[model samples]
Each structure stands twice: as C-alpha cells, then as structure tokens.
Target: MSEAGKANKARSGGRSGGRAARRTLRTTRDFRMLPGLTRNIPYCEVMDEAHVERLDNASMNILENVGVHFRDPIALEDWKTAGAKVVGERVFLDRGLVRELIRTIPAEFTYHARNPANNVRLGGPHSIFVPMTGAPFLRDLDNVRRNPMLEDLATFHKLAHMLPALHSTAHHIVEPYDHPISQRHLRITYSSMMHSDKMFMGMTTSPKNAEDVMEMCAILFGEDYLEDHPVTTGNCNGNSPLVWDETMLGAMRAFCRRNQPVLCSPFVLGGANTPASVPAAVAQLNAEALSALAYTQVIRKGCPAIYGHYLSTVSMRSGAPMAGTPEIGLMNFMIGQMARHYGVPWRTSGSLGGAKTFDAQAGYESASTLSAVIHAGANYIWHAAGWNEAGMHCSIAKFVVDAVQCAMAHRLGEGPKWDDFDQALSAVPDVGPGGHYLGHPHTQENFQSAFFMPELFDNNSIEQWVADGEKEITERALNHARNLLSEYQQPMLDVARDEALRDYIARREREIPAASELNQSY
Candidate 1:
C-alpha cells in the first residue's frame, strides 16, 4: 500500500457523535492495490479451451467476412496498406494480421501521475478505478438534480482527488452546462490537471480537444518526458455493429500517435445495439473491439490500447438500455478472457446501473456488476462511483457508497494473506477449552489490519447508532462526501506550469470557432 492508504485512518467523520472515532489502522501493504502498487497473481479464468477458441474464431469471421465500417478515409488507407481488403468504408482484416499486430503492443506499461510516487501500471493483474464520467446532470443528496455548473465540475475533481480509492478520473466528471459547449472541454481538462495529482482521461469530444489535452500534459510532464511516459487515456467508443465514426477515429489518431492509450470500447446494449444472446453479443463486441484495436496499431504500432466492452440488456418495454444486468456480467467475463487471449490490457464497466435514485435497485445493480469486475481480474474500471439513471446522472450519495465498495473489492481481489499463519494458529492453544480469543494477544495484534475498514458504513452498536440520529446509509454518504470535499487540498504544481496550462486553454478557446462539427456531444 502507498502512504496514502495510511491517511484514510488519520480521520473519519459523518457519524452522529460529536465526531466519530477514526479508525487508527496500519496500511494493508500485502493485500491492497493502493494508488501506486502492482498486482502479481494469475488472473482467474471463466472459459475453457473450446469456449475461448469458439469466441475467437467467431470474432475473426466477423472482421474478415462482414467487416467493420471505417468512416475516415485516412483510416481506410492505413488499413489498405496493411494488406486488408477495403471496399468503400468497410475494412476486412486478415486474422493473422490482427494477431501479429496485437503482439506488438506491450502487455504492461506505467501511466505516470503528476506525483512520481503515484505512477500506476496498466495491463497488469491489478484493477484501476475511476469516477463516473460524462453525466450531464448532477444529483445531490437532497434529490436536487440539475445541469451542473462549472464550479460543480471542479468540486467533483477535488472530491475525486481526496478519495483514496480513485486512482484517476474521466475528464468530464459532469458536463459543465453553465459554459458554452465550445469552451466546456477547455475548462474540464484544465480543472482535472489543476486539482488532481493522479492520472486522468483525456478529452474525446473532438480532435481539437485531443490536441489541447496533449498540450496540457506536455506542460506538466515536459515534451521529451512524455515520449516515454503516458499520463492519461481516452475512451473511444465504436458505433456498434462494426463501425467507427469520424470524431472517434480523429481522437484516436491524436492520442495513439502520441504514444498514449485509447480504450477501444463498443457501446453495446444486448438486443438493442447487439444480439440478445450473450455469446452472439460477445462475438459482436469482440469484432467491434478488434476494429478499434487494429486501427490504433495501424496508426502507431505498439501504442498502448485497452480492449473495452460495455454490454447491457435492453428494457423490452421501453427500449432503454439496462446496466448491471445478468447478461452484462457474463459479457464482462468473456471480455476478460478475450483480452487475455490477445495479451492486452482489459477495461470494463463498474458500479453501473439504470436506477433513478440511490435505493435498493441501484445498490443491487452496482453490487452484482462490481463483483464480476473483481472476479474477472479487470485492469481498468470507469464509472466506478456515482453513475446512475442510465448514465444520465452522477449522484453524490452513490459516489461515496461506491468508494467504499471499490476499496473493499481491491482488498478482496487481493485474496487473503498466508504470511505468519503459524502465529495465528499458535494462539489456538490459548483459546482451547471454549475460551474466547477476542482478548488473546494474536487477536489484539491483528484486529486493526486484519480486515477492510469501510469509510462510510456504520459498524457501531444499535444503541449508539440510534443515539447518533439513526441516519440512513445514503444520508451518511452525503455527509461523508461533504467532509471529503471540505478537506481537499489542491495538488502542488510549479506556478509557471500552472500559468502555462491556463494560457494554453485560453488560447485554444479563443482560436477554436464557437461552432464546429464535433461539438454536438458536449
């Protein structure tokens, strides 16, 4: 564990007492994937030999026969030169070519944070969690939902930095609706850099936004330093059923060419954007993922790219996409298998749901999906906290709740430690003949670091909980979030560098026209 983990034990509040007793526990260095640690165990597998072979063959057939639609002419030319069959916008890749290209990508690489001690590696056995992103509405604990202001966007970044569970965050934590669409990315990108020392996602709204993201990174890391160290990633979604749009491709060109990563994801909803059957959806998801992955290599061989899959079932009655569904978890397992097959980093959804509020439905949905994410040995998880309402809203209550869950998942995924088990067993003699072990020396020595201590869950006695206002979990979460935000301190950066970043954003905002082809999403 990083020293940051120790900070969690320094203080905790939001309980009913004058102030809750903060857990004074030491860090679980052996069993926790903290901000800068690496995981080293073999990932648990879900598919057998035949199942893996079948899925791979099916995805290969889709790419070679049905083909993926590449909208950008430059991309089509790149594929053509790589010996792919090109008919209009459709690019048919040979299976061997894809397999060979994939091998060029490194299985593991470090993503540096502004704080050198906080650098995290991708494509390892560990999991990295980021906060909810791209939600247009912000929902407070009071159930007040509205288009978020620019100040609200900055506050979310500050909160994310204070939360130890979050290693990085997506760029637009919530859309800053108070600003004009054209200027929104500028401020969003600037806020993340200024507020957090951890790594984060780059802007994907436009090719120009991609340029600004790179410029800001250069200002922080310096030009030559960025050549070997990647600091951020972008989630580039392919239009389902084998299609890559112009904006996504352009953004990929910008990020991949600079030796940064783009999570090549398929925004698939089973039976809506993909086939209803899990296997069929897996095949389509794999095919769509291949197209995006292949394009990244085509642009720059060995550029880090993650195999991303976001699968969900559709509500038959309303045609709305449903997250945290049984089918989605199944897809997540298969996606991990395929990523392992290709030897690349894998990305999956987290704490995702379609609930309209932070109630039973939301908790059940996020819990089920999060469990699969841990079991699948996923490497990167986005929307790990605060996502709700079919990705339309990010809730403050749920963010706090999910942070607790994320921390628990990391410790759980680490499995149990067997070190010095003999000492624990030695205490069995002291507890023989029905004598309690609670007062034993071994128990006394191990109690604080033996388990995962939650940040917001109440473990107090019933009487004590009642005395402390009998607050609900969500109510406690709201207060915990407020306390975290209140305690946040901006990460240190050189004063000149900060000014350079601001000047760059200001110039880009003035230079870019108010209206452009790719401003629709913002």
Candidate 2:
C-alpha cells in the first residue's frame, strides 16, 4: 500500500477505536436537575404523558384568556375566521387554534452556520446549543450609562466569531445611522455576506427592511440554495408587557414563506410584565406561547422555529431588567421544561450577570445561570457569554471568562466514565481512615485529566500578588483577548472567493457611497 494510504488507515482506525472506548465508558446517569429546583412544572417526575397534558392545558388557557393583539387587519381577519375572537386590533385565540398551530411546526430542523463549522443540528431527543452573546450593548462601559449604540453590527460579528459556545451568532446590538431601519438591514446583509458561512438572520424594527434583507440574502446564496441551505434567518421579538404587532408578524411570515427560520423571542420581564412570582411568570409564558406559536403557524405550517423565552426580573427602583438574578435562572429552567412538555426545541438566554467588571460576581453569576440551562436540557442556548451590567454593555473580558465556563459545562455534561472509574477505584483500595489517595496512580491519572479553568480570582500568596501589582480579572481577560485576536487567522476564504466577496462588497459600497463612507469612518 502507498504511504499516504497506510497513514490514512492508521488515523481512521485510531479515531474509530477512540470513539468505541468512550462509548463503552458511558453509564445511565440522570444529569437533569431535580423537578422543583429546575423548572416551575414537575418535568422530571411527571413523565412525558402528564407533561404533555400540562402543556395542552397551558396553551388552552393562554388562547382563551390572554389573547394576543394583532394590529394587521389581514392577520386579525385570518385569526377571527379561525375561531379567534377579534376585538378591533386584538385577536383572542382559542385552545384549538393554538394546538393546531403547534401541530403545524416541524419537530426537527438544521441551522446552517456561516461555513460547515457553524452549522448546527437542532431538535432531537435531547441536545444543546450555545451562543456567545445576546442583544447588543445596552450600557456604556466608559461612562457607565445606558448606551445601546456601543454595540454595532461589526462588534456583533466579531463577538460571534470569538464565541465557541454560540452555535449561531446574532446581530447583538443596534447601530447608529440616519436611517436606522435601513441601516440595520444593511448591517445584517453585510455581516451575513462577510462573517457567517452558516445560517445568519435577524429582524429590524421595520418590516419592509426585514423583507429586503431576506431578499438580498436569497440573491447572495441563490433562491434554490436558500431553499435547501437556509443559512440566513430572522428573529421576531414579541413586545413584552404586550404582544406581537403587525410589522413583526408580517416580517416573520414573509421570511417563513422563503424557507427562512424565525426565532420567536418573547421578552417577558417578571414583576413588570407579569407578576414577581414564579406562577405569574409561567402564566406570562403561556401568553407568549399563544402569540409566538400562532405567528409560526400563520406564516407556514411546520416552519423551522424555536420556542424562545427570555425572562428576567425587573428592579422596582431602577425599572431595569435584573439579569443573572435567581429568578432569571429559574425562568430559564422552567422554560426548558415547558419546551420539553411540548416536545419541541427550546432556546433561552443565559450567563447575563449584571456586573460592570469581570470580578467574582461576574464569574459566579455566569456559572450559575449557565449551569441552570445545561441542567434544563435546553436545545438552543443563547447568551452563553458577552453580557454585563444588566445586558447593557459588551465586555470582552467577561466574554472570554464565560467561554471558559461554557467549556466547563460541556465537560460536566460528559458525565462519569467507567474505564477511568475502575482505575480510580482500584488505586484507592489501600487508602483507609487517615490515609490519603494523593499519591495513588489513579489520582495521578485523573488529577489533571479533568478540565480546569484558569484562575481569575487571586490565588497566589500576598507577596506574589503584590509583586504582580495585584492585577484584576479584567486585566487578565484583556490580555487573553489580545492573544486570541493576535493569533486569529482569517478563516479560509480562498483567493478567488475572497476576491469575489470583496468585489461584491465594494460594488454595494459604491452604490451607497454615504453609508459606505459612514462605515469607513466608524
């Protein structure tokens, strides 16, 4: 055999043997959290039969009582004919319609990322999806004030590129421009064309722009390619404290017709949007279900979708949504359980600690929130990192820190393996009452085998800390970020492809000189 063929055979054999060994080590273990601690509903104990019943009841109550308002006349009329009560702009959906809509949605679908590297398989028996960041900057890091503009499309792209946990990157923030709506759509187009190889989609405030962006993406990838690949997608945010409006619904429908996936995000703020209590939160979630599910069904039956629930506690004094609160963690857990009840895929935000610096508070909060989601078995997890100061600002430092936390979660999810277990047990046989296993062969084998996070907290002695000038977590993280950026090789866009992409961007820029100039200046 040729040398290359022999090498290939050896490599293939190694990989196959390794996988078989890992599989053999697997054991039945329940990684999910206890029922009450994880979700508002008794998901773990109730079994699939009872869970489905609860979901049905919840959907019924939402449709009959907490009707969603639709400003669009056509949509309102459609709902009215479908047994929904139309009170002027409001459409009260009944339980039957909700169930019908739920049935229309597909149980599983694939989300293609920028490249093959970004593509993710979503919706199965049990799976997990993680994203790097959430909505763009709501806070100003320098001034320490509410500054949404701090997060731009470019920043979003960069964050997406950096985040390993995030399966798909999102337009995390709003940008500043004269025509904010048009500019937002342009940004999505530019980012999708330039940054992602997989599925990339978002929604602007304007329905018209949303449709335009989707069209542009179709043109770029070709209509036939989009029908099959569906890389670019859109998000529909149901206004919390209320319901989805005409524009959002229209945008979602338009995209869905083109085979684009729509993420139905219901931003429910506890205490403000609903009641402060958990039950009230669940009730609000039911209302969200009615609205978001109806929109999905309205667009096209069985369209690719996600049950997105972003619930946070509101501070009475500040009127700001308190991220990383215990309430947020509980809500994420409950939402996952609810999604499981429906036998549909779920997506939820996480690791959003309302901290200004990359300190202990940031680490602890991120870890806690992420742990909840992992334990909940959420299929699609957003905001795995890159949130701080109540979802206001984007912290480069915190992003890296949260990434380490995400890695930790993935490791924990692996559970205990028997191969190592036997070795560990065998080595510990001689250890008794006062004896230690530190010197054992098993200890040596497993000690450093587990993933360990680099310390952001000061772990050195006083003398060493003082000598190192008492550097903070932010300093350490900043250094780490610099190293990563410096080491980052532009992922393989070959010469021909690179030239084609550049020319395309350049042509677009020339057509809109003013916007191009503005981007350059920024």
Candidate 3:
C-alpha cells in the first residue's frame, strides 16, 4: 500500500470510533440512456466495450480530419517533426497517431487533498471532488462594493481549509500581495504546500504560469514520486475551441510524461461558442476530446486524462451564462455517459444555483444539478458549492447548503439494497400486517441505523415550521454554515511547519516585482 493509503486507513479506523460503519451502497441497475433531455442528443453509450470502440474511432476522426491548431511556434515544429500536418500554426493529427497515444494512457490515479482525510481516488470506478473558493475575493455581505484588495490569500486559504466537501481547492482568487506574472503560479504552489495536501494545478490560458506552478510541485514531491504514486497533482481547463495553442500543448505534454491527470473543461456557451441546438453542443464536446486526447497521447503514450464538459446556457436577453439551467444539468448527465463510453474518466459542474438572493432557486438548482451528476456517475465534480452569478462569486451560506446536498447525493448514490434491509419478513414474525413496528425490537434495531436521514430537511408539519420561526431552507442553511464555521478548528499544522510556510511566501513575495510595478512604463 502507498503511504497515503496507510495514513487513510489509520485515520478511518480512529474516526469510526469503534462503531461498525455502514457499508457503501452499490447498485445492480443497468445504465439507461436518457434522450431529448437536452437538444444535445448524446449518441447513447455507456461503459460497454462496443461503445469504447466507437469513441476511439470518433477521436481518431477528430485527430485526422478536424485537426487542432497550435499557436506556439515550438509546439508547431514539434508536431511537424512527429509527422503531423502543420499548416501555418495548425497541427493536423492522423488517426493512427491518436490510437497509439490513447493506448498509452493510464486508466486510474489518486489525488491527495490538503486534508489527508479528504484525498480522493480519481479513476477506475466513479468518484467526485467538489469545487470551492474561486472568486476574485471573499465578498463582504454587508457592503455590495467589490474590492479586489479586500481579502488576503491566507483568508481564502483558511476558508478552503474549512470546507468539508471541497476535496481540492483551486487558487482562491487573485491576491493583491503577489506579482501578476508569477502571482497565479506562486499562489497555487503556496496554497498546495501550505493549506492543501493535494492540488489542482494549471491555468487555462497561461502556459508559463502552468510550468512554474508545476515545477514547484515537482520540486516538493520529487519527480520520481510524481511518476510512481502520481497522487499529488492534476491539470485543468485547456478550454474547448479544442485547439491546443503551443503553450497549452507543451504543458500537457510535460504533465502527461509524469503520468499526472489533466482535465478538459470545455466551457460551451450555448448560443455563442456552439450551435444553439443541444446536438451541436455535444459536437463541441467531441471537439474538446479531439484536442485533449491528441495532446495526452503525444506528450506521453497513454497519459491519464478526464473528459470534462460545462454547458452553461447563455441568456439571450442578459448575454450571461445561465449556470442553473436545466440544459446544464442534462448536459452534465450526457457528458458522463460520453466519457464512460470512451473508457476515460469524466467530471462536471455541481451545486451552482443561479439565484441572486441565496434563496430557494439556489437550493433547488444546486441540488437538482448535483443529483443528476452524482446519479450519472461523474468521476470529478467542480463548483460543487459556494458559487453565484455563474462563478463570479462564492457565498459561504450557499457553500454550506451545497455541502450537505453533496453528502446527501453521496448517500443516495449508494442506492437502496438488501444489505441495507437487514431483517427478513420471517425474522419479524411478531409484527403482523398493519401492526405498529415503532416500538418493536426490529424497529429499534434498524430505524436510526438503516437510513441516511438528514438533520436540516424538515419533515415536520407546517405548524412546527411556523412555531420554529418559519425558517426557510436558506435560513437553515445559513445557520448550518455559521455553526460549521464556528465549530471547525483549523486542521493541524505544526508551529515549525507554519513558520516555514510563512517565511517561504514572504521570501518569494520580496523577490518578485509587484503587479503594478511590472506593468508600469519606465
């Protein structure tokens, strides 16, 4: 077993507190194809052998016919030497090359979250990690005024540290104290080393930033550790339009060589980037696969990669992405099915309700979208909670509510089963038809133990609600968030380690020029 595995096992044992833990629920229900849910008619395919073959062929077509464009000269030249068709900046890949690349990718890997207890397994069977803390700055609820300089990076770091559902925290917004050029890279490395046990590294548009941040990680974990255990890292958001600009392709190749995971977050704005129809949206997803798959294969034979699709609808009236739209939820389901068909891991967005006031719309939208992804079996889930205005803000109240929903989804995914149904009809002979089971031995034995009942969901009468101050879900969720925040102690970091981390950040800050200074005209 790996060191992480041993540590997790030891932790789990102590955490169980001598109580026999409930067995994880599993389902035997065959995967079903849901149609017309979105205009994007997913070519219905699940994790079947034939479906995998079809996906392989489709990817090859993308590589051969609809080739990817690389903006970087070095990346373009590398592809040219590899026998790819380079037209100006475009690299047209062949079907055979794509197949060879796909064959070399690994099927499974592990990811370590900052909290050792929160580490996740990324491939093989489906599992998920939710997003947290990715806004400009922590919003002060009282003052509506937006200030980029308000919250420090450490504050965002602590907030991420406190969130239970967030297995990995991305750089929590840009900080004022850091350099613009090196700010992102510095923040990612510092956050990962100081606050998190595991990390998601890479910026979608910045190749230099990705290189610097990943280099820091390689230094910390050692290159051999990255290649062997390969649990410490992953890359994200080489966005769709599916062309790998030279910089992104270079990063993908380098990360792939180390056997690190990469995410293809194709942000498809319905009417703009894609066709207005759903099928057209899915075709855009195919475009994402073409670029990401080719990059993965070229960098290292069979590097681990995930197929991620975020289909946020653009409101024609407002001209903003509608995150909580039903189409978004349905697209998440379809994307999971598509990724499974290709025999690759998949991820989707979650718990993002479009409500401005943190009300029922937020709760309903977040729950519904999250439920669909969980049921559809997505391997990784971003924006799991605490998002508002389509990723422009993070609400602590919303995050708390979403975390509970995530827990509920995890329970629901376990599904109803016989092991969960302990007592047989014959064993409960005394409880005759319509007889009260409430006071019976079997009832006492199973009632609390059998179900994963939630504490906040009020199943009480309206009279009870009225008597208890007529609190809505948001009110209850806010209360829960406050309680959790108050109750949550910082995860243990030794004094020496803490000082070392602080010193490291301070030293780095002094070395790099300020964001303003770098841009100033001499």
TM-scores of the candidates are 0.92, 0.76, 0.79
User: How much is the lDDT of residue 119 in candidate 2?
Assistant: 60
lDDT by residue (tens digit), candidate 3, 1-522: 999776556544444332222232222221111110111112323346664456556655665777666777777776776678988866677866655555555556666544445556765464665555456533333314254442344444444455544555555443333446445456555664665444444443345445555555555555576765554434445445655555556666656667777776666788777778664566566666656765666666666787766667889998887766767766665566666655677767777766665667777777777767776677777778677656666665566566667666665665555663546454466867544444455645665546656656785556869999998766776675555445534455556655655565566667656665352211
Highest-scoring model, TM-score = 1
- lDDT by residue (tens digit), candidate 1, 1-522: 567553333322223121312343443322122663245445557689899999999999999999999998888889889999999999998999988888887788888888876688777675788898989898874768888988888878887777777788568989988777777778898888888888888988877678778878889789877777889998899889889988889889989888998899998878988877989889989988887887789899988889886667899999998877877787788888888888998898889988998888999999999988888778888889999998899998898789788888777777678896999999988779645555566766676667677868897667879999999888898887787776676778889999998888778777766674346433
Whole-model Cα lDDT of every candidate shown, in order = 0.81, 0.61, 0.59
Q: Ten residues in a row with the worst lDDT in model 3? A: 30-39
Q: After superposition, how far is residue 356 of candidate 3 from its true place, in Å?
A: 1.6
Better of 1 and 3 by TM-score: 1
TM-score comparison, 2 vs 3, better candidate = 3
Q: What global local distance difference test value does model 2 have?
A: 0.61
- Give the TM-score (vs. native) of candidate 3: 0.79
